[model samples]
Target chain A: MKFMNNVYQVITVAKKEYIDALKNRVFIIFVSFLLILTFVSIIVSSFDFQAKVISYQTALAELQASHQIIQNLTAPEFYPLQLLRGTIEYIEIIGAILAIVLGYLSIAKEKGNNTLQLLFTRPISKIKLFFGKFLGNVLLLTSVSGFMFFGIYLIISLIGKTVITNIEIEKIFLSFIFSIIYLSTFFSISALLALIFKSLSNSLILSFVIWIVFVLVIPQIGDTLDPDNQVPGGLFNKIGITQKSDQLTILKDFSSYEKARDSLEQSSFTKHYERLIFALLGIKDMYNGKTINFIINDKNSDILWLVSAMILSSTLTSIIFTKKKLINK
Target chain B: MNKIFYIAKEEIKILFREKIFFTLLGVFVVMSLISSFLGFMATNTTTSIYNSSVKFLIQKGINNIPPNPMLSFGALTDFRNIIIYMFLIGALLAVVIGHRSFIRERKSGVLPILFSRPISSNTLFFGKALGIGITIFSIILSAFLIGILSSLLLPYRHLLFDDILRLIIFYIFSFFYLLFFGFVGLLFAIKTKSESLALFIPICIWVGISFVLPEIISGQNPTALLNPIAMGQVQVQNSVFFSLMQTYLQPFSIGGQYTSFALQLINNTSQTSLINVILNNLSNITTLFISIIGTSTLCIYSINKNNIGKDEIYE
Candidate 1:
């Protein structure tokens, strides 16, 4: 019965928030703005797609023709990873500002207007109220994201462009998931700040500063502070002690066919031990000085998701802070 | 004139009363100083390395075009990006200020008392917006000046008078953009009677316009300024798709190709010739136009019809 009541309270609060937000003229304008922006983006992106296709076709033809003239000429290297990384970084920076602003303002404004106290005075527990607000914000976020996706789809269909293939869809999905994780993290941070600062504007600025530190400053700091793992022989060097030793030992041991035969015929305990030692020591160094890399080839993206869950735990910590007496502060 | 000044003065005073406004200004000042110092130090180190490279090139009788003048200040090519960031910060600051400006007065039960006086609703609205706008403008200007001054006094020293003027112009536009949204925020705060909506509304607009909307419709690809051969303008770059607008956004494809007897096309770069840099600077102007006109229209309309004396507890 207690669990049901808790769930019920959370749902009721969420419903009220949703209804109130829907009735807000500001919310309506923002929704309209989102829809309009999505529409415009689609048209613009389609034009870009058409241009890319033409360029790609021309480049491919040029490459093939050049291959006939210079048989050994290799195609220029393309940096898809760099491009993907840059795009994701660019979008993340933009999204962080939006998330921080929204998250801080949502709680800060409520507190500023004293509506938060009224909302808290309800029969519901603080946890329920927190969750309800969070859920409501999530819904708003989803609506905006959905509008953007739909607009993009329409644009691709209108342009008859096949740029958004299955691979592109998957990449988009991953990027969106990463964005949501970051968004939730920002929300948690903002909520905590709102509770601590008591003013929307302060919370907004503080959250923004934190966001900048995390999104821009931290990565740069990480790069500069971490020492590069330089190899002894350098990147291109192929000198190998094991290879040299193995070659020398093999050459010395098998200098002649008769010597080799004599060595093979020796079945004594010492000969067996020697052979064992040699076999243990004789390792190939095909890659020479190349560093052994450990790649995470896990079948599941569970770790990435676990990060989001961990962030949620941090958000739960803010509830403890929220449960503290705000009026007294 | 007195009425406008009266409104502006009232607005400014109210903003001063808000603790957050002062805190933000203080923090912004500190951050500006830190970023400026760090940026200057980092750029100086890089400039020395580049100077040596220039000397080496000259010694080899290879004269490259002089480094762009604004490079010393990180304002050469990155000025566009800096402007965008400044505009975003300005808009956000305005929204936060606007969100609470009129709403706070009503929440404090002062609006009714103020309304009972000889003050008109328009004056009240104007006053509230002006106050917040002034504060936002001050913070942005101060931050830009600090950043510029720090950049100028760096060890490498390449800051020109033109750079400072350009930055000032950029800062002005930044405030203008923010003021446009600040007024809209004023409308939201007044009409919704829910400060939460005011803050959330502007954020959603910013996100939608800058990220979600742009990414969905056009991906990351910006429109090219001109065709590769510098002949004419094009809607998009032929080579790079979804790249941020930069010098490299043009099509890299050298013209001319060879075809085999079997009708297989091969890239024949042997016959390809170098082309001059062709780009259009108009797309950026178009973007500015859209943002200015769209946001201003909403602000002007909302303020014009706003019911400033409404009860505070609407939600």
Candidate 2:
């Protein structure tokens, strides 16, 4: 009875947030920008792949006309989902910023307009209101991810003239859910910061600083510090350790460095989200032909980290909004 | 000019007093302290691994081995990560500084009072712009001194006079590069009607400049920029669209120009003479000048057009 009333109050608040964001000009312009970038990046990649095959065919025909052997020729190979690389990165960087903007605006507007006091006088608890905002944003990000994935599928099919497999669809769906969780973590963090700070602009700038650290700086440090990235192709490939046995033999000597790099990457939810999504999309070669379950099993730790971070952040935001005297702060 | 100097000095003081600005300055200082060390650490780890591989090969009775290639690389080249750090964090910090320059005045209701003085809008605008320029220069100088200290303090590596000259040149260009973003922040701050939008628009523009344009030119995804070994720029580097993008947009790619400019001289990745490196970055110098002049022109024009009666704006 009372629980249902509380749920109703949360839903009402969430509905208002959704409508507010939907009407925002900044959000609209940014979503359009990301979609356009996705379209351009994927088309370029598709045509680049097609050009390779066309050139191969042209060479094969010339060889036949000149009475030359074509026995050793081979066509370029690639997975279709690999073209989603740009889309993934767009979501990681721009999408995260959009979430921050949403979160900042969420609390900033209430405080700016002095609606926080009015809302507090209402029949809703602060925790329910916080959860309501979280749910509203989670729904919005999910819709964006769904729209983006659908756009990617249409682009690949219409442009590349290929069919997406059922397994591929499942991978996209799983990636979609994790993408929401990743975005929601950022959303909650920014919301908490906006609630904590007295000045909205400073809090907004601080949220951006946190975004830069988690999204760009930490992951980049981990990548640059990687010993394998020292060479052009890779250290392992350059030094004749292509064989799995030999590679394992060599890696035994660098376990400490590798562990340090892994632990550093583990600290960033962006990296975990990236790892999980890239595996699901078959962007990494080792997982290209692997089953969805196998990829899920292999990337279980990243999956857990992303989910846990999202839940923890949301819980923390709720607790702070409830326990602290932050509403009027 | 004296009034301009006075106003510029005040603007700098106001920026230094901001807590958020101080926080980012601390991050920039810490990164600068570790920039050269991280570069050296990467080289050390790579060389150590290569040596181990060589020993393994020799034990297996292999005939020949390759020498350590990283040893031949220049000392300044190890500072590549620092260049990227400036591009990311330094640019954002500059934007915040610029946004605050005008927005702070507007929030505090000082535009009318300032206009009532003998100072013209041009004087005030130039004063603020000069203030931003000096602030960026001071930050870069601190990083420069830190670079020198790191180079001197490290034992395994040494920087020659030429290496120091290259660092100086790179930091000089970096100052202009960061100032352009500051100008962007100023332009939008002066023009935009909303407070959050003022900060928001400049960041979007920064993303387009630093990430999207280069991605379009290279036809490589942003992921490749992060971890290169996973997916490289091999396939699209040969496309017609890639060629066209290079000829047209690559010259004006603000971030790309800065990156290649630094990489050519400091990283020595191009293996060219210093004069050749400068000639290669001719586009960088021209476009950076154009960006600075154009943005300042708009900022100056916008300042004159500012609504004097408007004290505060929508969020």
Complex DockQ per candidate: 0.08, 0.55
- The complex in candidate 2 yields a DockQ of 0.55
Give the least accurate 10-residue stretch of model 1 chain B, judged by summed lDDT.
Answer: B254-263
Please tell me what DockQ candidate 1 reaches.
0.08
User: What is the lDDT for B272 in model 1?
Assistant: 21
Cα lDDT tens digits for candidate 2, A1-329: 98899999989988988988999887787778777877887876776666677788888999999999999888788789987878888899999998898888888878888887888887787788887888887888888878988888887777677888999888888888888889999999998898888899999999999999899988988988888787767777776767778766777888898898889888999999999988999888788878999999999999999989988987888887788785555
lDDT of 1 by residue, A1-329 (tens): 99988888877766766676567565466556545644554444454545656666666678787774544444433222112322233334544444554465466557655776776577766677778777776665555555555455545445444445454454344444444555565656766777777455466657765654445433332222111101112111212223444334433422453243333323121122222221221211231222222111221233344354436644764565556675544
RMSD of 1: 16.3
Candidate 1 wrong stretches, greater than 4 Å: A1-49, A59-180, A197-322, A326-329, B34-42, B45-84, B121-133, B173-175, B208-235, B238-304, B311-315
i-RMS for every candidate: 13.2, 2.6
lDDT of each: 0.48, 0.84
Best by DockQ: 2
Model 1, span B1-315: residue lDDT tens: 577678678777777786766665564566566544443333333344345445544665767535622242233222222332343444556766776676677677787787778877656655665676677777777777777666666554455554465455446545665665676676667666565555566666555443443333224422110011111111234534444432332211100000010001001112221111001223443445465566555555654566455566432
Candidate 1's TM-score reads 0.58
Which 10-residue window of candidate 2 chain B scores lowest in summed lDDT? B227-236
Which whole-number lDDT from 0 to 100 does residue A125 have in model 2? 79
